[model samples]
Each structure stands twice: as structure tokens, then as C-alpha cells.
Target chain A: MPKKSSSTKNLRSALRIDPEDGVVDLADYSPRKITTGPDSRKASLAALEDLGAELVDLQTRLYADGVAGEQRSVLLVLQGMDTSGKSGVIDHVVGLVGPEGTHIRAFKKPTEEERAHDFLWRIKRELPGPGMIGVFDRSHYEDVLVTVVHDQIDDAERLRRYRTINEFEAGLVAAGTTVIKCFLNISYDEQRERLLARLDDETKNWKFNVDDITERRMWPEYQKAYAEALAATSTEVAPWYAIPSDRKWYRNWAVGVLLRDTLRDLDPRYPKTDLDIPQLKRRLAPPN
Target chain B: MPKKSSSTKNLRSALRIDPEDGVVDLADYSPRKITTGPDSRKASLAALEDLGAELVDLQTRLYADGVAGEQRSVLLVLQGMDTSGKSGVIDHVVGLVGPEGTHIRAFKKPTEEERAHDFLWRIKRELPGPGMIGVFDRSHYEDVLVTVVHDQIDDAERLRRYRTINEFEAGLVAAGTTVIKCFLNISYDEQRERLLARLDDETKNWKFNVDDITERRMWPEYQKAYAEALAATSTEVAPWYAIPSDRKWYRNWAVGVLLRDTLRDLDPRYPKTDLDIPQLKRRLAPPN
Candidate 1:
């Protein structure tokens, strides 16, 4: 096992929710905490840029190592409320990696075909191959989060889904996937500000949805639902980190730190070649 | 019908194949031809940058128009030989358009489930929604090209596919989709150079496939197959443009120009809202 870095240890202690005892209240987490030492936004952003560059190298190695027979992958699951910076995190943080090894799937409302199968069927189809970094903009967690909030599934069904999710994630981990799940925890006040900004800016008007306001009305119920789901689903194999996301710079930085640390821990190495290098070199040399 | 611009007219007249005649010989077209006037590669790339900016605006309007009720879209079908730069076109040209309005589907070899359905069934599932710019990295054209080259389908099946493709494109056209098909034409020598470069570069080694070399040996067969397929499927509603793609700058610019002109022809407008402006203004005003 690799020795844990001070930064990774700090982040895990600060951000990771230990649900062994019970589910924690949303009121316990602040939506604007900047774990990085920088007090100013500019300093935090600068730090994120550094982390982004380091992440690119790590991801490239991870991809190359996977291609070389390591057969390992990473899945980053992002879940949050509307305008809570899920897309923003993808664009600013995850976008740092090259497309060659990065696969992103943004799940919309299920189609007739998707709904026809078990909920996890579509999710399984899009899993990243060996040496890939797969990102789910919203994931299987949606089944529990949305279904429970809307009362589409009764308590019995909801409990079953939590067990199913745990088993599914455990399978992924066994199959050599390191899973990282994050909840972009944004305050209601921050979300209102974002929605208003979208409505106010003509360029951003395309992103504004009237339905988001309707969801905002059910904030308390959704919060309770998320708390229960995260508590039940968070496991040793796939832990959940509630990211304070009111500050865009801090959120991006924190996620970047998490990924950089995770990749460092993985420490994927280049594959050892079995080729006869001397013979190949002689064969490739130009004829005299 | 929208009036065609001088640029669009020039491109259509110069690059479009007259499929009504017969299958055209690949030797008849020069792969190095730069349709855009500038002799310098830098000037060509500079021109592409300008076109890229305009494309962003046009795509935004196209997406907004789709959302507003126009129910129109554009599908860009790119087919080419290996190392002919299909991915390059997507990155440099298509990448200019925002993800919000752009949908890209890179079709790989068919899965068991996909093969069970008619070839067109999978294509239909991935069609861009109204107001989106959908790109098929390798599309249904693959069915005719690869299958015919390998004799995977009998002559009778091949004939049926041609008819199916033409009819399918016609249906898409009737449904308000403006189809632009581009066959990136590259010479055999250019591909050899690209393959050699991939072999030499450590980073690009991942892209160098032994099977690509095997495929290279069957180039003549593949060329003949593409010629026949293009001739059979090229229609007035969906014409095929054989782009001279040896010059990367010229290829990128030509594609950008094609899209810019196509979007200009479309002239997608922002949807007119049904809201009463005066009443909404009064309602939104600060309470006195």
C-alpha cells in the first residue's frame, strides 16, 4: 500500500462523510469552505491550475498503464442540485485530461429502451474500458435520489436500490475500477443566484429552466432524500464526498485535489515490454 | 429556399461529385487541391479561425431555434481512410461549437444487440435532436464501405443497403435535416508517412495498430468500394463532397467553410417567445 500524503489525508478527514454511525445533516457542511491554504479566490484558482497540470500527466500514465496490461480504470461520479456546478466541474476540472482516455456520459431522462431494462443495464454499457477515466454527470444515484424524492419507489424499493448500488460499485471495484463519488453541495441561496444569473444573461438564457424553480420548492425533501441515499450507499470501496460548491474556484480546486491525490495513490507505471529489442532494432535499421 | 452565397456556390460546384453519371475514379481528383484561395498554410488556418468564431454564433442560433419550435437540424457525415484526419476535423472544426448545441456519436464495430437490428436502426437512435449539430464520426456509410470491401454482405444485400441509405437520407431531409457528407480524400503515400510517424513517436505509439498495416495492403479494394458506395448514395438532398485532405490546414479550413456556409443557409433564428413583454416587464419590476 502507498503511504497517504498529508494533503490526501487532510481532504479525506475534512470532506469524507463517515456514515457507519448514521447519516449526517446537510446543515453540518458549509457550502463555501476552501480547504486549500489560500485565503483569496485568486490563490485557490492558481493552485487548481497547478493541480490540473499534474492530473494530466497522471491520467496519461493511467491510460498507458491500462493499455500495457494493468487493466485498471477510474470512475468519477458527480451529483448535485440544478446549477450546482456539475457541468462546470466537468468543463473546468475534468476537461484538463485529453479526450483519448477520458469518456463522459451525461445521462438525461431515460428513453423507452433504457427504461425497459433494469436501471443498471444502461450504466453498465457505458463503463470505461481498461485505461479510461469515465465520468458520470449524474449517475445510478439518480435512481435512489429522484425516485425516492418523488415517491415513485416506496421505502422497501428504496432500501433494495441502496443494496443494489452497493453491490454494483463493489463489482466495479473488484474489476479494477477506482470509484470516486462527489456531491456538489450548493446552498439554496447560491442556486437562486445562479438561476437568476442564467435568466439575466442573454447568452446564458439557454441554460435557464423554469422547472428548476419547482424543484427548489422541494429543497427540504430532496436534502433528506440525498442524505439517506448517500449514507446508505457510501461504502469502503466507493465513498461519497460532499463538496462545498458555493465558490466555483474552491469547488474546482477541491475536486482537482481529490483526483490528483487519487491518481497519485494509484501510481500507474508504464508496461514492461516483452519484445526482443535488439532484434527489432536490427530489423528496423536501414539497409547499407 | 435560401439563397446560396458565393462561397457555398463555389464549393458545391468544385468539390461535389456528379453521382448521376457513374462511379468516379479516385485518380480524377487531386488530394492536395486547396479550394480556399490562400497558398500559405498559416493564412488558411487564420481563415479557419475566423470561420470558427462565426460557426459558434450560428450553432447557438440553430440550437435556440430548435428549442423554439423550428424542429430543424444539421448532420455532418465524415467518412475517410485511416489517417485521413476524421478525428482532426472534429477537434479543430467541430470543436468550435459548444457541447450544449453539438452532439457527436463515434460509431464503433457493432455489438451483438446492434447487429440484431437493421443497420439503420442504430443510426436512427443517435440522430441529433432539433436544434443540435449532430456529427457521425463514422456513420451508416461504414455499413456499405467496410462490409462491401470485405464481402461481409452479398451483392444483393449491398444493393439493398444503397437503396436503404438513399431513402433514409431522403427521410431525414424531408424532416428538416440538412445533410452534409464529406469523404476526406487522402493519397496512399500520405497514409504511409502518417503510419511511419505514428511508429516513430512514443506518444503516438498507442495509435499505431498492426491491423492498420494489414488494412493498408487492401487499400485499392477499399478505394473501389468507397467510390461505388458514394456514387450510389449521393443525392440532390444529400450530396457527397470529396475533400482534398492531404493538407491538414486546407482540410480543416474547407470543412469549417462548408459548415459556416451551411449554417448561413440555415439562418436559424432565436425563438420568438409567447410571453407578453409589457405584462412580464410590469410583473418583474421591483415592488413599490
Candidate 2:
């Protein structure tokens, strides 16, 4: 079960990957592990619904703080392979929050204009304003993962991009933004089942891209790329959390827990108005 | 009562302001009117919940159409006075739909750069791509309403803006967009109660703006401005519907119904795949 927030254990830490702990290994983490979520699907779904109500409150408070000129915001970066539920998490998890204060961006293949600029150019453009929760379906981390796996960039370039990303995140942290990077870790076999499921369901056929199969063929190479990239860029300011994704319910539950805890820690307050309340109330008493 | 969809009444027409019918006289409509929603608050709330589940399915199908390269999209433009519940409708109504397929843009005052360009420039930039639902808290109509009300432009200039806006919306329709403009019809007393309530509640204090009072003081001017603008712009291409807004429950229920009916009318189909399904399924027979 997703442990109660009041519990002595720090549940957020359970998902975090601290590179200093060891060489980050993807093989060690089971994609189906129900580390923080309820074991049963029925209870897990209930837990998630309960969490959604709490998340909405926390998120709106953060938004209210921004309205009072608070600079802090949260950025939840979602990274994963095809069918690993990046969009699914966004729909099921972040969708729980009101869109008024939630900003979502799903990055696509770089346009010629975007490619002409630096890798972070388009990303910088889409950053959520103060008090908003920004969910990135894919992020600048793609630079360190996809290109490197495809042989478009060498180790030296990848290393430089890593440094650039760290500095970029550091700047964001200094500007009062908290970054939560979630790596949705889905297993190869589980992915095959998902892709096949899409093919079997006619309504889901639009989601079945031929490129997904091509990308899955390079799963081992992509896994190595992600393991290295996650290790390289998972900074203290913005650490990467590898979310087990073979079980969709568990993955959503875990991500929800991460967000709820992060917002609670921030604990944004409703701004105390300096306006003379009684005087305003008196003024408003007159009928138009 | 919010009549069932199967009824022969064509309830959507009751809310819509057809320009050919007559000039939209705001005096004829009651802010507390329960024209197209259930009479009792409890029933309307329950009805809204029921409508939500059906709306979600319709919205996703529209999204699926976009994934299959369809060009159609829906834009719901919300306009009203202070505390007319624009954001509330989004949180309560549109929030039921997944954020993946829904795009929301809340326009604040134009910055220095925005004022430097044509009024429609920023609006055009934020138009939803294919198979999306776009909600505008305030929209291009503001040029004709707010600025005109404040007398920033002469009558001729106001007429020019109305023409420009109509052309712009026409362009959008020609490009396969269905525009649903809703003028949330909240009363002067309702605005006073809402603003006072915001100040009375600690958490809602952040939403209490001094500017809201200044604008609320101009309720009469704003209403007249809205009436004229709605009549001018509520055309064959994209008509404006005056939604009774004193009852928050009815306001949300009405908007939800508007969206559901529009999508159902459009009847977006899931895209059919041309890929060789059998061969791909067979190729997936070999596991790595």
C-alpha cells in the first residue's frame, strides 16, 4: 500500500535514485514491483482516487501562493519508453488537478526551427509560470537518451549536455522551482504485451506506431542509455525517481505519492490579504 | 429541469443566441434562470456527474481522431464579469476530461510585447492543434468588450474590431474548428456576493483582487458591452450562448452539456489503421 504520509518512513525516498548509492542498475529494479502502492488492483485504484482529492488541495494551495506573488512552482518530468504510460500517467495522475493551474507539455520530435536552436530552447519556452504545476511528457533529457542511443552524439557531447542540464536545473532551483524527474521503468516483455494489446484493439490502432516496434527492437541499447543518463543527470537539486511501470496502477499510485509529498513539503500558504476587509465588505454592501 | 438529451426540445438552442433571431437583449435573460438544467440543485449536480462520464468518452474519441491526423478541433470561449465562475467551470466541468486532450489558456493583461502586435497575434499562437478541445477564459472578444467599455476606442474603431474578430473566427472555422462562445450571465448582486465571499474565506483571499472591485463597479458598463459584442459576433459560423450563471451548479452543467452535444454532433471516429495487422502480430511472435 502507498504508506500513509504520517508514517515514520519517508516514502518519496523509496523511489529516489541517488547515484552516490551505487552504479545505477536498471536490471535490479523490477518493473512490476509494488513498492509504495497497494498490492491489490482494487485497493490501489481506491488509494489513487483518495490521493487525487488530496493532490487537488495541495496543488491549488501552491497555485494560490503564486497568485500572492510566490515564485515557487513544481515541474514533474515524465520520461519513459513507448507504452510505458507517460501520457497515461499524465491523464490518470496529473489530470486529477484542475487545468487552471496545471500546465502540461508533450514534446514531440524537434521541428526544424527547434532543432536549429539549442536542445533546451523549446523546453525553456514551455516552462510553467509561477504557481503552476508543469508536467513534461518528454523533456530535455531526451537529448542525453535518444540521440546517444541512436549514435547521433558521442560520449563527449553527451557529457556536455549533462553539464548543461544540471546547470539549467540549478538555475531553476535557484529561481524557486522544485523539479521532480520520474523515469517510468517498463520491462521489455511487458512492453510487448502492451504493444500487442494496442494492435488487438481497433480503437487503439491509432496509437500503434510502426516506430514503436523499431524502437523496441533497440530496447537493450535504449536501456543502457537510460541507465547511464539517469545516473549522469540525477542531481541533488532534481533527482530522478524510477517508477516501476509494468503494473499501471502501481506506477500511477507511486507518482501521485511523490507529487503529494513534494507539494506538502513546499507547504504553500494562502496569502494573508493586506486589504481592509471590513471596509471592503462595507463598500460591497451598497446595491448597484 | 435539465431535460434529457432524447427529448425533442433541442435544449442547446435555448441557451444559444442566434443573431438572426433578434438583437441579444441581456434584460430578457435572468441570471438565475434554470432553462436547460435540472430545477433542483441536487438533481442538477447529480445530472452533471452523469453527463461527465459520457463526456469523457466523447472527448477521447475526438482526441483519437486527432491522433489519426484529423484536423478538426473545438474551442470553448468563456466570457463574463468578475466572479462569473470562468475558472470554476473549468475546474468543475472541463476538469472531468483528461488534460491530454484538453488545452486551456487563461489570458491575462497583454505585456509590452503583446501590445506591439495585432490583437489576434497572441490568440492565433495559442489555437489548439488537431483533435483538441481549447477553452479560453477570456478571448479575442475582450477587444470588443473590455476596451470598448472603457472607451479606449471610438464607435467606428469598435465596429472595426468586431469585423476583425468575425473574420478571424471565420478563418478558424474554415480551417476546421468549431467555436462555442459562452457569455456567462452572472448578475451584479452575484458578483458582490462572490467577491465578498472570497474576502470572507482565508483560502479564497488570494483570488480577491482589488481590480475585481474596480471592474465590479463597472458591472452595468460591462453588461452593456457584452450584450452588444455578443450580438455582433454571434454569427452563423460561431454563435455565442448566454449561460445563466448565478447558480454555479447550473452554469457548470450547461457548459458540460454544450461540449458533450458539440462533440456528439461532430461524431469524431477512431482512425482506422492501414498497417498490415496480421504481419505485425506475427512478427511479435518471436520474443527477445
Candidate 3:
């Protein structure tokens, strides 16, 4: 068995929220925590670039391995409040790999048809096939997170959804998917600044939502809901990492590091071909 | 009614294919046709940059208009053979706009469930919502083009699909979608070079499909299918443009110009607010 890399070990210790640790308090995790050394912003950016290149290689190997009949994949689930920079991470970190190997699905308000089925129905359909990197910008967690915040579902139903999510993730794990869920932890003040920036910029005005302000008004309630959801669902099979996302560069860099280390832990290999190499080479030689 | 811009007029005259003209022969079209002036590659690239910025503004207006209750949207349908730079056009032309307002859907081989539905079922589900710029990397056109080439469906069924596509597109237009379809036209020789390049680059080997070579063997058949599909589906509501795509820079420029003109024609306006401006302003006023 291969051992986890030191970088992976460091990231796990720094970010992972183990369920056994009792109820999680959102206030305990600093949104601006910098795990790297002082004056390390430039180094973090450079390291992110390096990890991005390595991710491209690892993703290709994962894709090739899948093509060669390996039933493995990686699903990166991003959950966060508005202006938490989920799209930024997607554009900078996940976008490094070729689009062919990356499957991005942003779940919007469920249509009547989608709402007719179980919450996991549409999600299961969109899961990355073998050898693909699936990024869910907002995922089934919304079933619990938003629904709970809006009082759309009762506490009993929310708890049931949690159990369902755990089972669904366990099934994915058994089927060879390494699920990495990241909750972009941004502070109330940081979110206010970001939302204000969106309103002020003409180009970004389309992204500003009155609903976001309404949601922000209920910040404490949301934080409580998130804490409960994370504690109830974070499991040994699929863990949640509370990423300090107040700094855009740090958020992007940290996600890249986590993904890079996770891929390294998987250590996907290029499959060997079954064809007779000498015979194929002889067939392809110049006719003369 | 607003008159079409001179650039739009020039592009249409240069690139639009009239179905009434009868039977599009691929041999008659030059993949290297430079519609702009000679030695204008630099100017074209510069113009593309300018148009890209304008597109960002236009797309925002379109999105804002939709948010303000206008039901308008744009759908860019890109259809082409392998190595024809469909993804390149998407990345360079459409990617300039922020992802928040852009919805990209790349269609692959249909699954067992998707196949069970009518051909257009899955296509309809992925259509861009109001206030969005939707890109279909490869769309319903595949039903007619690929199925016809491989004899997956009968000739009668193929004709029915053509009619179905026309009806589908007409519905989209009636409902306020400005549909622009582009066929990236590249030559046999150009495709061969591209495929060879992909094989030569170790980084791109995963993108090298053995099926692409097999499909190349049937290039003539595929070309015939495309020509038939283009002629049959090109209509007043949703016109088809046979873009000369052997030159990547020119191809990107031409598509950008077409989209910029289409948005200019639509001329979506930013919505007017109904809020009490004085009260809101006072509430948000900075503290002394």
C-alpha cells in the first residue's frame, strides 16, 4: 500500500473536519487563515501554477486509465455562500485541465421535472464517468443547505437527506470515485465587500442578486445550518474541507493544493496495452 | 426596425449559405478564404479583441434585460468535424464573457436513457435559460449528420429529423432566442495535419481517438451528410454560415464579428429600476 504524501498529510490536518469532533462551530475556522509562511503569497501563486500542470497530467492519466477499463473517477464538490469565489476556483484550478476531460455542472433552481424525482436522481445522472474530473459548482448539498435555511424542509427531512447523502457518497466510493468536498468558508464582512463590488461594477451587475442580500440578512441562521449539515454528513468515505476563502488567491491556491495532493494519493497509472508491440511495429514499417 | 450594420452585411454576404441555392458542394468552398483584407491577420486579431470587449458589454445587457423580464437569449450552435477547432472558437470567442452569464453544453454519445427519449428531448433540457448565452458545442445537428453518415437511421427518418430540427429552431426563435449556427469548414488535408499533430504531441495523445481515424476514412460520406444537413436546415429564422475555419485566428474573428453584430441587432437594454431612489441612496450613503 502506498503512503499519503507529506503535502496531503499537511492539507488533511489543516483543512479536514472529522465528524467525530462533535458539533462544528463556524466561528472557530478563520476565513483568512494562511497555512503557508509569511510573505508567501507569491510562492503560493507559483506553487499553484506548478500543481495545476501536475493536475493536468494526473487527470489525463485518470482519463486514460478509465478508457483502459478502470472504473475510477474524481468528483470535486464545491459548496459555499454567494460571492464565495466558487467560480474563481473553477476557472483557475479546474480549468487548467483540458475541457474534454473536465465535466462541469452548475445546479440551478431545479425545474418542475427535476423536482419530481428524488434529489439524487439528477445528481447521479451527472456524475463523472470513468476517467473524468467532475466539478459540481453547487450540488445536492443544496437539498439540505438552502432548504433548511429557507424552511422549505423540516429538521426531520433535513436529517433524512443527510443520511441519504452519506449512503450515496459511500456508493460512489465503493464504485471507485474519490469524492473531495470543499466548503469555501468566507466571513460575513468579506461577503458584504464582494457583493458591494458586484453592485458597483457595471460589467458584474448581472451577477448581483437581491436574493443574495436577503440571504445575507440571515447570515447567522445560514452559518448554523451549514455547521449542522457539515457535521451530520462529513464522513470517512467522503470528507468535507472547510477552506479559508477570504483571500481569492489563497482560496484558489489551497483548492489546487488539496486536489493535487488528492490525485497524488490516488496515484493513477497509465495502463499497459495488450497488443503485441513488435508485430504492430512490423506492420507499420515502410512498405519498401 | 434597426438596419443591419455594415460589418454584419459584409459577413453575411461572405459566409451565409442559402438553401434555395441548392446542394452545398464542399469542394466549391475554400477553407482558407480570407474575407478581410490581405495582410490583415494582425488587424483581424486586433478587431477580434475589440469585438470581444463589446461582446462582454452586449452579453451583460442581454442578461440584465432577461432579468428585467425580457425573454431574449442567444444560442450559438457549432457543428464541425474532428480537429476543426470547435472548442477553440468556444474558448476564444464565447469565453470572453463571464461564465455566470454563459452556459456551455457539449453533447457526447447518448446514454441508454437519453437514447430512449426522442432525439430532441435531451437537447431541449440543456437549452440556455432566459438571459443566458448558450453554446451547443455539438448539438441536435449530430442526429442528422452522424446518424445519416453511419446509416443509424433510415433516410425517411433522417428527413423527419430535418423537419423536426427546423420546427424546434423555429419555436426557439418565436420564443425570443437569436439562434446563430456555424459550420466550421476545414479541408481534408487540414484535418489530416491536425490529427497527425495530435498524435505527435504526447500531451494531446489522450485526445487522439482511434475512431477519429476510422471516421476520417469515411470523410466523403460525412461531408455529404453535412452538406445535406446544412442545406435542409438553413432557414430564414435560423440561418447557417459555412465558416472557413482552416485559419484559426480568422475563424475566431469571423465568429466574434457575427455574434457582436447579432447582439447589436437585438440591442438589449438595461432594465429601469422601480425603487425609491432617494430613500435607498440615503440608506446606503457613507458615514461622515
Indicate the docking level reached by candidate 2: medium
Residue-wise C-alpha lDDT for candidate 3, range A201-275, written one tens digit per residue: 655666666667678878888899999999988898898988889988888887887888888888987766554
lDDT of 1 by residue, B1-288 (tens): 111224634775577777646666777667896544456799988888888668878988887787667889999999999999998888778776644456677787898999999998889988888877888889999999889888899889998999999999999999999999999999988987787776665666665556676687788999999889988987889988888899988888888888888999998776655534344334334357
Q: Where does candidate 3 chain A have its weakest 10-residue lDDT segment?
A: A1-10
| 2 against 3, candidate with superior DockQ | 2
Model 2 residue pairs with clashes: B1-B37, B2-B37, B2-B38
**DockQ for each model:** 0.20, 0.74, 0.19
Interface RMSD of each: 4.2, 1.2, 4.4
Ranking, DockQ, top scorer first: 2, 1, 3
Query: Candidate order by TM-score, highest to lowest?
Result: 2, 1, 3
Score every model by TM-score.
0.86, 0.95, 0.85
DockQ of 2: 0.74
Model 2 lDDT, residue A222, Cα: 94
Q: Show where candidate 3 strays beyond 4 Å.
A: A1-9, A37-57, A198-208, A268-288, B1-9, B37-54, B202-205, B275-288
Instruction: Report the lDDT tens digits of candidate 2 across residue range B1-288.
Output: 122233314667787776545466788677896655577789889988988788788877887888888889999999988789999999888888879888899888887988999899889978988888899999888888889878888999898988999999999999989999998989888888898898889888888888777887787888788878887888889988888899998898889888888988999888888989999998777655
Q: 1 or 3, which is superior by lDDT?
A: 3
Candidate achieving higher TM-score, 1 or 2: 2
Off by over 4 Å in 2: A1-8, A20-22, B1-9, B20-22
